[model samples]
Target: MKIYVMVDIEGISGVYCSEQVTPASGRFAEGRKYMTEDINACVAGLRDAGVDEIIVHDCHGGSYSLNWADVSPEADGYICGTIGDSRYVDIDDCDGLILLGYHAMAGTAGAVLEHTYSSKRIQNMYINDVLVGETAVDAAIAGEHGVPVIMVSGDDKLCAEAKRFLPDVVTAQVKKGLSTQGAVLLPPEKAHRLIHDKAMEAVKKLPLIKPYVIPAPITHKIELMERCQLPNAAGKPYMNVIDGRAYSVAADSVEEARMRSGG
Candidate 1:
């Protein structure tokens, strides 16, 4: 079966500092390696579970953190860049989705790197009136095509949040949030073991977990940091300026919402 993997950095094992998440920062190289290791572990686990084809999307900052060449050649995958590609989790064609290194929603308590899109620009984000993070949005998109989010790995807070959103999916808590920009990390080896085990288990129980779908008439609300940027950013038709910092959009589906957000 084909499994789609979406990898983010904030929730990766041993990642507890903002310096690790940014490319300009010195620790970013190590963070990138750590992220890749987690993805590889998931791939290895899925392969062990008899999954033949896997497509991985590097969905972190600018969407180009993971080194595509470094990914295991055994399971060929694609890397999603910042230019806005259409190949993100084609749920209609995939058997399951694995959200790796996901984080909590914006403004959540005890969440590491608690921000939707940008810690500075985006104060909050809502999909179908439910406040959600990137993980939630990706899950909703996967659900639109009847693909179950079989597994998710991130911080403890994010794992708990994922359970609330995808109750039946398997989750691996690689770290615990000590602050918005810091966390208590689990060793890389331990994190990989947990991810591998959980991923394998998720595949076995994939049929038990239901796809998470946002009801029809999807609504999006983005709370921007700059009030002036709001009007210029979301000037598309059907997008209403809720206030200086908030803008709302009504769409028929997640795809429409994504387009509205310039995704």
Candidate 2:
């Protein structure tokens, strides 16, 4: 079986503060090590499960977040650079997709490092009137091609978010968020073991998990963090201004809506 793994930095094991996830911060190097090791743990589990192909996508921040030298050699391929371009992986043929190190969406109370696609510009996002984070959007994109999101790993809030949206998606909670930046964390050793075991469990439960499909003719709404962004959004041909800080776009595909609205 082929598996695609999508990674983000904020929810990575051993990561707790904003500085650790920020590339410019001196503490970010420590977070990078944690990110790579967590990915390796997942890769090891998938390899042991007899998966033939494992593709890892560095979906966090311009795709330059991963520690390339430390990534497991067992992984078949690595996707890097700016996301949503030609370099993005084609998940159409993958049997399952794993969302690793993802956080809850913006406005999620008690979610560590919570934010949707953009922390600075975006305040909230919704699809078909349901609030969603990156997890749902990415899963919906994969679902369009019939691939199910089998597993997710992060803090308790993120795990809860995954379970609420995907239902059957296996989740590994490595930390418990007390606030946006504070969390009761698990040691790296324990976190890795959890991720490793969860990867195997997710693969085993693949038959019962279904792709997260959003209804067609989807309406995507974006609420900006500030009203200043409204003028810029109103000029976009694809955008329909809902109010001073919000805009909506109608599209048949999630990808199109995201691309058109710059979500």
Candidate 3:
């Protein structure tokens, strides 16, 4: 009955401006508050759903985006700070994973704050030739460990992306993205309520959900935004430099491929 929750800031309700998610910006704290409340709503729902243990992870850049003090007391534990590449830590032991405040992949039309893993470095990412976002990446990691992603929350595009990647996943769409920095938002209270309801619904439907497995021998490909971002691995055995701005890594598992790619 344990569940893991991964929280990001870009897609939270009322968060539309890029400065709101930038740690150096004066508006960053406001975004953190919104993220914390959204997670609390999900936490409350999970608790009501009879989940025994809940763990929340700050998945945003630097992992300092969560207002931990404002998070629900019901959550059993929290993981924050520089967690490095071991993003799937302890996910194998959880019954389900929930993605909160996630957004769409890079180049997604009308997706708010749209970008893949790194907005500055990565222009695009694909697994088995299918373009994906953080949602699919996390889902594959969980799937590698036999954990199903049961719920996701974000803007309309993100929710739709979740459904396309993870079957039977329940989603809470808090806003409708009009552009990269703009969205038609739901009132905070309404968004939180929807999250609460969807969280419970996701857990309730868990029995019908399945792990989203991207078959073995995964080919992790990355398209860098700038040619200079490509690492100098001219003769590396593990990597195949596609071009000046692209590279590919091959591995038997999704996690291994991601780790090797430094994703």
Candidate 4:
């Protein structure tokens, strides 16, 4: 079995500040250590379940939070960078996708370092009139390749939000949040153990998990915090600009919207 993993740092255990998520900051290394350990446990669990191949991607800001050399030896390969459409690279060959160290959308109460794709650029986004975070957006993208998201690991709010979109997905919750920048973290060791068990269990039940899909002829909108962030073709035939800040697009699917926006 083959699995693809998309990992972000903000939702990792012990991570709840800009110093941790910001690349090249003093706390960055510590944050990466937590992320690496959590993913390693998941890889170990998948291996025990007979998984043969694992592909991991660093989905943190700028896609460079993880040190490729420190990634799990069990993984077949690691994606170190992003190119607009990089999130779903080689997705078709995988049976399942796992979201690691994820968080709730920006402004979500009791979530650690909450935000969508960009905390500074995006204010909020919607697919078919339902507000969505990165989980939903990215899941729909992975669904285009027929891969279901079977597992996820993050804080309490993130796990709850994920269940709403991926009802049957197995999740490992690592922390309880007091505020966006505050959380009662699970010890690294404990968090890792939970991840290992959850990964194995989710993969074991993979066949029953279905892809998270958005219906055809999808209508989506992205409300940007800054007007200047709006795409150049915002007012075209299938797209529109609201108040010069929010942009809406009508596409056959989420992938189509991303491709059209050059995301």
Candidate 5:
């Protein structure tokens, strides 16, 4: 089976500061190591499950945070930022998707590093009135392609969010968010083990989990930091201004939503 893995940083174990998630921050290097370890564990587990091809997408800021030298070369993957296009889950040909090091939606209580797209610009995002983050958006894309999200690894809030939308999908929580900037983390080794084991479980039960589907005419509400940014943000067609800081868009499906968001 083919699997697509998307990796982010905020939800990795021991990441509780902005510095860890930013490229300019000194602590980002350490966060990269932690993120890499978690991904490696998941890859190992997927391999154990007899997955034939693994396509990893570095989904964090500008992507390219993980050390490519350390990753298994056998796995074909793409570093984030390399592609100028905004395609979140480019899993058109993959069978399953795996979300690694994801985080909670913006404004969520007790969620570590919680923020949708940008902490500076995005105030909140909703799909059909359901509060969602990157995970939810990407899962929708997977659903559009008839692919199931088999596993997700992140903090407790992120895991809980995933379970709320996808009850049967496997989740590995490496930390518990106390705030957007604070978290109680598990040791890297322990977190890695949990991710690996859970990934294995997810793959084994992949056939049992249903793809998350959204009804036709998908509606999205984006709450931006500045009202003036609305026109630019709504450059795509069919985007209507609901109010200051809020804009609405309609698409035929979730994948179309991603396209509208330039994801």
Candidate 6:
């Protein structure tokens, strides 16, 4: 079976502070180790399940969190740099996707480093009138192509969020957030073990997991954090920039919404 794994940094095991997630931050090196190890563990687990192809994607900021040295030789390929480029992924042929090191939506309490895409710009996002974070949005993107999000790993709140939308998704909570910037962390080894095991479970229960689909002609409403970013929110074909800080995006698929909303 083919599996796609996308990993972010804020929700990785042993991450609790913003400094760890940013490339410019002093602790960023530590964050990279955790992020890379977690993915390797997931990859190893998928291999044990008889997975033939694993495509890795660096879903975090600018895709700088991972490097060639971090990737496993078992991986079929890896996608780095800016996301939303379909050219890098064979989404059409993929069987399932795995999300690792994800956090909750902006303003989620007790969520480790919660934010939807951009913490500097987006304040809230409504999908078909339902509040959601990047996880849901990304899932909807894969779901549009008939690929179900089978496994996820993150903090306690993010795990809850994933379960809320993807009831059958296997999740491993690597940490628990005390505040947006604080969390009760888990040892890297322990977190990796959980991620590996859950990934195996997802593959085993593949038939039980369903795509977390959203209705077509979807409408997205975005609330911005900074008024200065209004110009950046310029409208798209089906998306309209409203009230400077709010944008109304109408798209047939999640990738379209992501493109229009610049998420």
lDDT digits (tens) for residues 1-263 of candidate 4: 89998998988877878788777688888888878877788889899889999998888877777766777799888887755655677789899999999999877888888898888888888888999998888888999889999998888999999999999999899998778888998887888889999999998899999998888888888888887787887347888766788878889989888666543
Report the C-alpha displacement of residue 203, candidate 2, in angstroms: 0.8
Top candidate on lDDT is 3
Per-candidate clashes, comma-separated: 1, 0, 0, 0, 3, 0
- Find the 10 residues in a row with the least total lDDT in model 2: 82-91
**Candidate 5 wrong stretches, greater than 4 Å:** 84-90, 232-237
Q: Root-mean-square deviation of each candidate, in angstroms?
A: 1.8, 1.5, 1.0, 1.6, 1.9, 1.8
lDDT string, candidate 6, 1-263, tens digits = 89999889888898889899989988899888888888889999999988999999987878878857967888888888865555237787989999989999899988988998899988999998899898898898899888999998999999999999999899999888899889888877788888888889999998888888898878988998877766453334676778867877888876777776665
- Please give, for residues 1-263, the per-residue lDDT of candidate 1 as tens digits: 88999888988898878998999999998889898899989999999998989888887878878876688776776667764544374558888999998888888898998778677778888887788887788888788888879999989899898888788889999988988877788887898999998989988998788888988888888888787667554347778778887887788988678777652
Q: Which pairs of residues collide in candidate 4?
A: none
TM-score between model 4 and native: 0.95
- Which of 1 and 5 is ahead in TM-score? 1
Candidate 4 residues lying further than 4 Å off, grouped into runs, are none
The positional error of residue 50 in candidate 4, measured at the CA in angstroms, is 1.1
Candidate 6 pairs with clashing backbones: none
- Per-candidate TM equals 0.94, 0.96, 0.98, 0.95, 0.93, 0.94
* Candidate 1 colliding pairs: 113-180
Candidate 5 residues 209-242, lDDT tens each?
8888878878888888886666554346677778
lDDT winner between 1 and 4, please give it.
4
Off by over 4 Å in 6: 83-88, 232-237
The 0-to-1 C-alpha lDDT of every candidate, in the order given, reads 0.83, 0.89, 0.90, 0.85, 0.82, 0.86
Candidate 3 residue lDDT tens string, 1-263? 99999989998988998999999999999999999999999999999999999999988998888887788999999899987678856787899999999999999899999998789999899999999899999899898899999999888999899888885899899999999999999988999999999999999999889998999889999999888888766666778999999999988988998888975
lDDT of 2 by residue, 20-78 (tens): 98989999899889999999999999988788999999988878888999899999999
Best by TM-score: 3
Looking at model 5, residue 219 earns an lDDT score of 89
lDDT for residue 186 in candidate 3, whole number 0-100: 98
